[model samples]
Target chain A: MEGMAIRLQGLRKSFGETTAVAGVDLEIRDGEFFSMLGPSGSGKTTVLRMIAGFEAPSGGRIELAGQEVTGLAPFERDVHTVFQDYALFPHMTVEQNVAYGLKVRKVPKAERLVRARKALAEVRLEGFGKRRPSQLSGGQRQRVALARALVGRPRVLLLDEPLGALDLKLREQMQVELKALQREVGITFVFVTHDQEEALTMSDRIAVFHQGRIEQVGTPAEVYERPATPFVASFVGTSNLLEGESAHRIVGTPGTYSIRPEKIRVLKESAEADQPEHATAVGTVAEVVYLGDATRFLVDLDAGGRLTALQQNLETSSEDVAAYRGTRVRLQWHRRHAVAVPVPD
Target chain B: MALITRTAGALHRRPRLRLTLLLTAPLLWLAVLYLGSLSVLFVSAFWTTNSFTSEVVKVWSTDNFHELFTVPVFRQVILRSIGVALAVTALCAVIAFPLAFYTARVAKPKWRPLLVVAILTPLWASYLVKVYAWRLILSEGGLADWMLKPFGLGGPGYGLTAAVLTLTYLWLPYMILPIHTALEQLPANLLDASADLGAKGWRTFRSVVLPMVLPSVAAGSVFTFSLSLGDYITVQIVGGKTQLIGNLVYSNIELNLPMAAALGTVPVVVIVLYLLAMRRTGALSSL
Candidate 1:
């Protein structure tokens, strides 16, 4: 962990009897964009806060740049966080807000202004320096928060759902900008988000957390394609879980198997079994959902199991989908597409 | 059902009538009672009092104002009153902030409401009893002297200092309540954000907590300042020989009604000016 920006060794935190984060170990390399993806109460934010030195870990040690900082205060650590609500100081202008960290470190006033301006420029908020945070739009306020955290050139930047307040379009746009900014500054970013798409898109690597523990840690594709557990498979993306006899009939295994919705192909029941390298399932289309670019079909298999299949609407019209509402269909997919995972308790 | 629904619909259609009904009572009370009496008081301030008969003369004169400015005793009393009011306000603020912050931010969730109730419990007690209790505490050999005697010190012994201390204790709840509410409404995330941005606890309190709570502090001060400005009872009990503007007004009310009215206008003017200054600092919105 010498070259890592942040390392958590057996990190844990408990609020009385309820443990929030339990024995989590992670090594986030310097300059990499890492994300903790989980549902609420899964301890992702707690982990990020511990790294930023806000929450004292109940057990174990936290090393920032190879220096143990478990008992240190947030300001004592060379890290900063962009909070979920942006937390812009209402009384201060954007420049003052951005210059706060520098001022705390006793940076000269002239240099603080220059560095704040530079940081604001990096976030494309150059003219927003004089404006109060309340005067800015939500997206602009989030950018100022980012600038404030970034101005100090912290070793690791912890962001707890910084873009959670933005609307869909703005959130997507910020995702791209944040990724680019991470690359431009080459600073270690430890982001926390509950939105799976956000984690997949913005993160170089992601740790899927569940019940105060890391279920899986991998790159976006690895976590999505080869999810380590049933929790990861179900949480990271759209996964169709099959188990027991259905698992055996579908993938020749008697245990649980996970398949992606997009990987399953739907064909007319009477169509020739032309693709022999693929496994087959015969089921009636239980439900159909049209989602602009794709159509999702809930198929009830003959083996008493139901699985969902999503097909691109590239060559099919609404009429074609309606015609298949009650019709029988054959679901086909490569044998390699089904992944075996542990049964969740 | 139809009658009730129809009536509701009719009321919904006529928002103006509903608004008028909602506002009429308070508006009338303000116009007829509060403002009406205030206008009468200010009008009487301009009239003259007969020197021999003690009758308020109708002739427009500035004699009271002239005396208020020219008389050394009046000037001294006015400045002393303002000084005492300011000291009380400052002491209340200094005491209230930490107590409010503890109740709002630092204390456990189960204890917060209890702490607030403890702070407010004093308000329910009799004001006279509380003042008399303070007089006993400040008496030459009362609790204040007993507590300080071992430390090689003596109590303030019923002087300006005793008045100030008593007034601060009396008005503390007024200061604590608004500051506590403001601090309660302060988002916990803002403090976390400050800490996350590398600000120490004290620095965060100064730069983040103080500015945001200033408006509430000013609002609380409005209560303490104005109340202290017009209060003659506590001073009479504990002030020894101190003569504030309130004491002057009370002494003059029976002998010279016009002079009392003129002197009464001072606290009102001071409060209004203070509110105006506070409004410039955005305290009105917080209130």
Candidate 2:
């Protein structure tokens, strides 16, 4: 936990005509829960594989705990991967699967059994050791996979969409459990996922990727609130992008500007007579959507554009939410909340 | 046409009816033709033969069984047949594992199918032709002798060794195909997971690949063992004076059909017992 656990410089991979990971440079801190988030075919998984030494990078160097491990075999590297499919050996019992790494290291039989049981217990699976992997539930099998990887005590753990196969409720529950487990183990956990919400909830820092390149890397709040590019803003969360004349009229900016829906305020004409001090636009309400905990209003601005504003329910009834439709309301926000992002071609 | 279509639709609606229809032909053939003939063979084994006229007497007697158990030549031939079958199976497995692994896992994707075709190409030649070719290869001053001459050694001439070698070569595809299929069906990520768990290549092969493929290996051995046990032609072509149960059965078939029937039961019994023993080891479940 004292130095960088994983580092990649100029990592590139290509399969015939298509490039998967194109020149990725990254450093993961010791014991940090870092997430690589992207859509499918965005090369996030390839980058994770390169770090785990499963795929030799077409060009680059990978350093694990200050030692260069490029071109090394997966077992030779001080890293482990929790594959998306779990990949539990169907023929092996849970205890044997968990003890596999120990056995490979040539540990004594008694110690291997004891450590495997302890690792299984750490995953909250205590008496299910003798059962085969096919006999376990998907969630239980996932935990077995985690135990199998964790029992090896590698310097870093690389997960490639480890919970992508689980149902929503189980995935959410495992997300919390995985974050807690990483905290307990104090191992650098490099998690790869395409689900933005999953990355947001579990990661200490996240790298958002697009089309084989890292678009932005930051803390969750920073990436969500101040996205560095148009792709990050659109991919991370719901953002209303305003560019060209609209951005100039609103923020006096030439570049594209992104505003989160929740940051804009919908003001009624009879409310306190207060006005926005930074930026304001008057528009007629085009659509009003009533969520249980929040209300959304789509405003058609006088400048011939649409903007979305979200407001918390805040003791308001559904009737009030319905009344906002088709009425002219002022969409207001502070200038600081309007983040400028690079416009895509 | 409408009636036929309606009938087809009705049958499709009932899965059990469709399954019964699908299975009827094979079931009837197996029950009436194959098993019926086998039962006739088994019954013939119990009949007595008149030594004076060589006529078969349909009497229920254990005389044939007694000779099968008590005769020294019968016992020697039975044991030798089993030993040759077992040896051929073991040798085929030892050779097939590496070849199948290379074809299924190590060879490049483009080369895999080519390798499989290469392994199967030998099987396309007629069985008789292959055995005859091996006969030449094992004969004096043949290809095997010429190759071994550099080391100052000669070929193992026509005998049990030659029969074993020829049979192993002939039945190798049977072993390689099933094991290759098993290895191919294995999930690619499983190997990666083992390596990720810090298991080296050899350990992964021992712990994961070997166990998963055991069933397929057992399935392959069934082919090799049973086929080797029943083979008489290969031995006739390659075996000089050595006698197996198959050769004994062949020699007795025309003059003493009952004795040949009894001798034929040896391989059937041995194969059944072998299958049962393999089942005890959980090989059937894997298959």
Candidate 3:
């Protein structure tokens, strides 16, 4: 249907003997912000390249707006990509870089220039059009790259770690701006990033990739709270994974379970499980990590495994938490917060 | 030994003295020997040769330059030499761009060093040997004519064309190396970004690849143009009757030393002008 912007069925890619993307099936909805979150060598970028028609799938069908486009060249595909390196032409001015796609599409020079100016304004780079890409700062060049890709108004915009090069402060700022820009353009955005926080902050739905396959596809909350596999449990965020004897003793089940560190509460040694739905474990504090806004407590559980608990620094300073090291404490969480995950082969 | 150590300590403390000491020998060579001969040649261009006695007289005159600009044979040779240089440069560029692109981008990574070595192998042979080899190829019933005989066409025998061809062959490695380096340094992501933005292969090449490599091409052209402009031996070996500025200078060197120096200045002046033009294209900075 028209509601589906992109569809990949049994898509696969291999380089010589190495399989980069084994098999992937995905459908990105129209006007949705979708993210493929994975580590390096996990094949997330390869799939994005396939959708952009830069790499042909070894065995798959790629349909864009319900039309089969697996055999098309990159120029023939109605998609644009913002590269991680921000590959703006160094020879051209910012205006020329932004107007390049329109020029390729045979848009008249006058009209393309006006559209380029508008795109630059959208990225808040109105007066910087005449400057060369080399003259701009890293963040400004990033904005120019965005303006260049969006000037054509393609059906789907694929961004491959476009913000990965920036410093953390600028990256966070651009993340907010990019999300706002995606909403305003109402275009399908397939973002690929290794940073889970970036994916969670921007994507309406996230597909977590591991090895060469999709581990889970769901909303950020679902993937973080209820991971489908043990790999997804540890990758999406920090997780307290209990398995085998530890799982049976603490969770009352003989299987793997993932409980988020933020979900577990570090309490006084004499604390009791006040609610019937609470799961409690007693442990000695092994390590105390003082993050600025929150303190992390790593407890060596008597039940045979270690569990990490993140407590907000409300009334405690670094010295106060540092003194908690080697002290006895109780870790408690709602039983529902711990979800069962499948064991990896 | 104490004096040597004290001098060393003094040199280390004085950076300016150290830099001056480091540059003294090279500066002496460049200024006294290299530029010294060039200035002497320019100064002698103004002196005249005795017509009857055939002896050098230290009398300054503009007659050599006057004859250089006004004589029909001299003007024709100047123009023809410039034309041949331009033609050779153009042909080298036409051949080198694709060859360099393939060697730099399209070839397998393992083959790249081998291919570069192959290009450089031609340069290791003596220049005269290469030109003489071309001489045999362009001679009557040689390889070129023998190959073209099946097509009922004759080879371009020893002439301006033969001279240009030999010069292009001689200077091609120079052109290929710089452009190859530029292309190799070009990031692969720019090409992908171009295609991803809807530009096809040729369009990407024209708008992205060519502009970025123009400085390198200009750098290569400097070698090709100057080398072709001043060549006399290749023309003599394979040029048949073609007379370039080098031949004119060589012939006039003994009998008409002033005229020979004047004619030599023509190539130097042309090269200087060519360098100015290339500098406008931002080539010298890249070089």
Candidate 4:
């Protein structure tokens, strides 16, 4: 990218015995909404805290707009953070909270107040400056926390699970609002989250972390469709994972594979000779789930665990399913959709 | 809102029979043991003493109160006692603050209880024994003199300094525990958030720790003031004529009970004013 907002090289951090971030390296483009997604203990939050300067990297260099910020104090860094708890000073009013950094930077009082009012309006919290954090609801407090971080006009914004504390509906609302916020501001953003859906909905790109390493970095669809490891594939969405024996080798690669349950199709009766070719697995119908638009079924595989198959409820009768439960059946999926991922040792 | 408060209030308003039963024991004790005793003192304070007979007469007089002020020693004693108590409170605050801060904020979890036990072990011992032990060290022909004999000085260190020092030692832990409790309960994240915001070290201490612990300071002051004010034994044992109000009250009551009653009113009034000021500030209610 022509203007790199933040470039981290070999960022490593450890707490006494536990190494949290181990040599993470990346460059976030200017005006990009970059997200770090991972399970707990995967060091995504540690990376965000390192960028925010709440934590110092044991071995690495962090650059923002071509200037080094690794040794900078949290306030000294040209980055602001929205914490998961929204860490608003309960004693201060909304306006005072937003004006804190500006006042510390010695922005003149008149100018600071104007900037604070504008920031409050940015988060749609205008006329709420007099209220304390305790006086506000969860959503309003989150907006106040955002305004406090944003009024400083830092080069980069770091959001650490900022919507995690909200309920489901509010989380969806804030995700859309945050996406619009990022588009309007055009500042580089480094968002950290454990929720795969939030990361997919908001990010321009996501770095999926496992243990202390990035397993893959790509757009949401790319990572979902072509997950490089079993962890990423299983973590991203629902799947009917399968283990298969090798056919005659073409390129001699290992042959373990997985397919989405939705890809499996059910046929009413046994077809004789000419059926569209796909690999087939036979099992007995173990269970069925009738979701509104689709019906899902579990097929007890001969090997062990059940294979899930999701079928559309295109017909009202489900006459085909009348014979499904406890009935022997064959399932098939297109060979191409069966993705290959590295199996762990 | 008013209706909800009334409904809640109804539940709490004491039932007439239960209230009367609960009030009976305390009311009886107060009416007889307290009020009855105070009535005798009040009457005795005004009773005239026959000049030659050395017997108290039932006739009313202001002579006891008159004698209290007419004597220079009693007035000096009153002022000295206040000075000693105030000094002890100030000393306790200074010594207790760092210990309380360390216990509440800095010490690790395992070591914290150990430090608390170490600080409180002195309190577990008998108060009389502790004061008596100090008496031996401060006396002229005691271990303090024995220890100083090598340097050719044998002197009585037992005076006003000894009394003040011993009183502070005894009550210092009392002052510390309440302050420690208050400081411990203060929202710890508030301090962490302050530091993360840009304030470091002492700035965080001044803005967050101090304001939140003001109630504790008020609590500690209450203990130190009330305790040292009522304590005449330490002064009499080690004071060696370094007069205090407590010692003055002791001698006046011993010499003439009516005179002592007149003298005792000073501390009672001071304590009442202290409580009133604390209440007005909402300091006591905050607890």
Better model by DockQ: candidate 2 vs candidate 3: 3
lDDT of 1 by residue, B1-287 (tens): 99999988998999998899889999999999999999999999889878898988999999889999899998899999999999999999999998998999889989998998999999999999999999999998999999999999999998899999999999999999999999999987888878877778899899999999999999999999999999999999999998899999999998898888899999999999999989987878988
Highest-scoring model, TM-score: 3
Model 1 DockQ reads: 0.78
Rate residue A171 of model 3 by lDDT: 96
Looking at model 1 chain A, report the run of 10 residues with the lowest lDDT sum: A268-277
Clashing pairs in 3: none
Full-model lDDT for every candidate: 0.91, 0.90, 0.94, 0.80
Predicted structure 1, TM vs. truth: 0.95
Candidate 2 has a TM-score of: 0.94
In order of TM-score, best first, we have: 3, 1, 2, 4
DockQ of each: 0.78, 0.80, 0.92, 0.22
Q: What is the C-alpha local distance difference test score of candidate 1?
A: 0.91
TM-score of each model, paired residue for residue = 0.95, 0.94, 0.98, 0.78
> For model 1, what is the alpha-carbon lDDT of residue B78?
92
What is the C-alpha lDDT profile of model 4 across B131-232, one tens digit per residue? 999898887788878998999987558788889989999899988887788777777545544544556567666656776676677777788887888888
The interface root-mean-square deviation of each model, in the order shown, is 1.1, 0.9, 0.6, 2.9
Model 4 vs. true fold: TM = 0.78
TM-score of chain A of each: 0.97, 0.95, 0.98, 0.89
